[model samples]
Target chain A: MSSAEKPLIGHLVIVGVGLIGGSVSLALKKAGVVGHVTGVGRNRDNLELAQRIGIVDAWTHDVGEAVRDADVVLLAVPMSAYASVFAAMAKTLPEHAVVTDAGSTKQSTIIAANKFLPGPERFIAAHPIAGTEKSGAGAAFAELYEKRLCVITPVGDSSATALALVMQLWEKTGSRVVTMDAAEHDDFLASVSHLPHLAAFALVNAVRRQKSEGHDPFCFAAGGFRDFTRIASSSPEMWRDIALSNRDALLGQLDAFQQELNGMREALLADDADRLLKEFSAAREAREAWLAKHGDGL
Target chain B: MSSAEKPLIGHLVIVGVGLIGGSVSLALKKAGVVGHVTGVGRNRDNLELAQRIGIVDAWTHDVGEAVRDADVVLLAVPMSAYASVFAAMAKTLPEHAVVTDAGSTKQSTIIAANKFLPGPERFIAAHPIAGTEKSGAGAAFAELYEKRLCVITPVGDSSATALALVMQLWEKTGSRVVTMDAAEHDDFLASVSHLPHLAAFALVNAVRRQKSEGHDPFCFAAGGFRDFTRIASSSPEMWRDIALSNRDALLGQLDAFQQELNGMREALLADDADRLLKEFSAAREAREAWLAKHGDGL
Candidate 1:
């Protein structure tokens, strides 16, 4: 490989061989950015599938052994499992190893790293803002993160070397790296990602309850409802963990959204057509403008 | 044509030849179920385009002339213009003409028909539960209503002949016809269609408010948000009219949804992982099961 395409790390250990972890490995493998990738997970079938699909160079169940001599350790599991996973790696992580993560939330991940990682300065919390409703090793591909934004929220006192390594790792995978404060990242994501997911879940339950009253609407739920509730088919366990991990930010967003919803309800109740018209027109204009501006970025 | 494919009407007059109206004309014309289609609209350009595309055989700016010699009158204007359009057609409609509509809400249309039409029995209020986000004659297609549900709400003391003629018209266009009470149709549609639309609009405004405060969450919106807000980009004026016409039912739905949202907010505030998990998991399960059961129908 050319110097520009040289591997960034000697040995990399991925703690979860699922969608996010598997995709990261595949992207790095395609770019020749890692010397070797070890898949560490409890699911042997998933790990085997990842290795069979060429996402990892090998498979291992022992997280401690996998990170013993690794140059980079990536925690790619659910947020709820971060504490135990970090503790396991802390016991055997190499002295010079840099740590990173692909969790959706940042503040929780940083806290876990601070408590468990030997040198929390080596941990760079990252969230690659890209995924489908599907999960598991079977859903991974090298292009999953291509041209997607990967926000790297560097905790205070992070080592420059560790930050540079994490930044280069994502850039080589065709991701646009952006830096933001961990708290701000969590707050922003709570509105854009977490809140939307919860709203979809709530919508399905509301409609289902109505259906149980003998007025089934699913038969007429075509273009609009299908698209709107598509994410309601996402993994339940994953979403539950995300909701609990980012409780504060998610609750704040939910409150803001309730205020907006109440305003709409009041307009409808008071028969205020002008107010309803203004709200609907403004929303349509803003959404159309955003789509035009981010047509490619999205 | 075969006996089953026989023409259903002699001359069909379609007022407001936009997406719904234009599509009905095209579907009937392609099936050879109508002898001729006359398009009526304030926009001469749109009428001409509809005729040029063969959605209508001829065009007219005069509603009187269009319905004077017609055997069937299809009112496909926005809900807001129903009263005026109904009154205009009432003056010149042929005695034996079967009047029908393609409005979203039924109770309001039925009330308009009662007030404006000389013989309310001849006006069968109908709603074809199918459409794209697009509007205007240019976005119409011949198969837009194929296998779609068309709910016909027949007023008490209606003429059987007029109702039969209207049913035959939709059936000829490959639509599955079902009869429902006008009030019941309005209530069901409020939950499935109008409420979802309002929620989507409110969500966009809420996020936009945050963006104005310098934290733009839209930049991170992905597949879920795009699908959920796709309907937010629909015609604002049309939605405003629907919201007002079905004010009572829409308000009821808004209340129900608010209860659900408030429950979610409380769960998040209390950090009740179990409640959040239960809600998310139940929603995911129900949605997936619904999709499986209605896969082919949708």
Candidate 2:
């Protein structure tokens, strides 16, 4: 193979090979940048599915065994499992292996890596800002990260070589990589991702509570409600882990949103038409501006 | 022509020929059930566009003149314009004209008709639960209402013949017609539509407030945020009118939703992982059930 087409990773280990992890393996395979992928997960069936679908060259339930000869390792499990996963693979991880993750929250992963891994300096925290309401290996696809933003938050002691390799890994998946502080990443995600999911969950529950003996409010819910609540269908356990991992930032976002909503409720109660119009008009203008700038590709 | 192929209405007058009004006209025309459609709007340019696009065969700036020879008059204007439109068409409306509206809220339209129309009994309050986040005649299409729900709220004094004709009109556009109490329609729509819009608007504003000199929170927003806040891009003035018209019901919904959100906040604050999981799981289950039953067509 030409040097440009040479495999970037000799052996890749993917822990928790679900949507995010499996997609990374598939994407690397599609780019011909990985020699072999080892899928590690708690579920035997899912690991088998990943391998059968060619997302991984081999499958194993043992994380330590899977990462023993890895050139690069990706942790894509639920946030709640990060600590234990790190502990499981730390002792067996190769001295030269570069560790990274496709996590939603960066700071927590950084913390787990620093606490459990022998070579914390090699751990590059990343979050590919892409996914659907669906999960699991079956939902994984090579193009899942194409044209998406992958934010990398490097801790102070992070190895520059390892960071570059992790960056190249995501770039091979057709993602644009940007680096930011871990805390900043958490704050931004709280507003854009975590807050929206919580709002959706609350909205679905609110509508559900309104269901009485004769009236089913969902019967009248059409396109708008459907789209608004789509994220409520996402994995509850995964979201709970995210919420707890980024509790402070998420709680702050929720407070700000609650206050904004209360302002609207006050305007409605007081019959302040002009204020209501102004708030709604401002939101419409801002959203349109955002769509114009971003092109709505996501 | 055979009865099935025959025109249901000889002359149909549509006021405020925007998306909803224009779509109704186009669907009827496509079904060969409407003849000689007359478009009325404050904007001459939009009226001309509607006629040019064949959504209407004729155009007028005067509501009274347009409905003078009408077999059916459809008010598809903003809720704020309902009273004035009814007043304008009241005197010149043909005695046989069956007046109807494709408004978002039924109770408000019914009240406006009762207060301003010469033949209140002939006014049928209807809401076609279908549309995109688009406005104006240019965005309308013949297939907009197909396979959607059209809610009809017949007032106690509503004429049977007028109600039947209105139902037939929506049915011709391929809508599933259902009759409900005006107040009940308002309540259900508050939970499903009005409240969602307000929540979206609030969400956008909350995110916008997070913008600072070095950071624009919107830069990190992706597909989930886009879908969650899509309704925030709707017409502000139109939403303002709906909010005011459906004030009581929407306020009740807002209160319930706020309580639900606060409950989630409490769970997060207490670090009650089990409680958070339970709430999120319940929402996921309910939304999945709704999607299975409704087929997510919307």
Candidates' chain B TM-scores in the order shown: 0.94, 0.94
Residue range A165-230, candidate 2, lDDT tens digits? 999999999998999989989999999899999999999999998898776889999988988998
lDDT of 2 by residue, B1-298 (tens): 2555657898999887888999999899888887689988888888888878889888988888888899999888888998899999888998988999988888878888889999999999899999887789999999999989999999788899999999999999999999999898998899989999999999999999898777688989998898899999888998999999999999999999999999999999999999999999999999999999885567
Model 1 interface Cα RMSD in Å:
1.2
| Candidate 1 Cα RMSD after full superposition onto the native fold (Å) | 2.3
Classify candidate 1 by CAPRI docking class.
medium
Per-residue lDDT value at B234 in model 2: 86
A1-298 per-residue lDDT for model 1 (tens digits):
4666657887999999888988998898888879889999999899899889898989999998899999999888888999999888888887799999999999988988898888999999999998876789999999999999899999669999999999999887789899988888888888878888899999888877877455577766766777788878888788889988888888888888899998998898898999999999999998998899776666
Candidate 1, B143: how far from true, in Å? 1.5
- On a 0 to 100 scale, what is the lDDT of residue B262 in model 2? 93
Clashing pairs in 1: none
The alpha-carbon lDDT assigned to residue A55 of candidate 2 equals 94
Q: TM-score of chain A for each candidate?
A: 0.95, 0.94
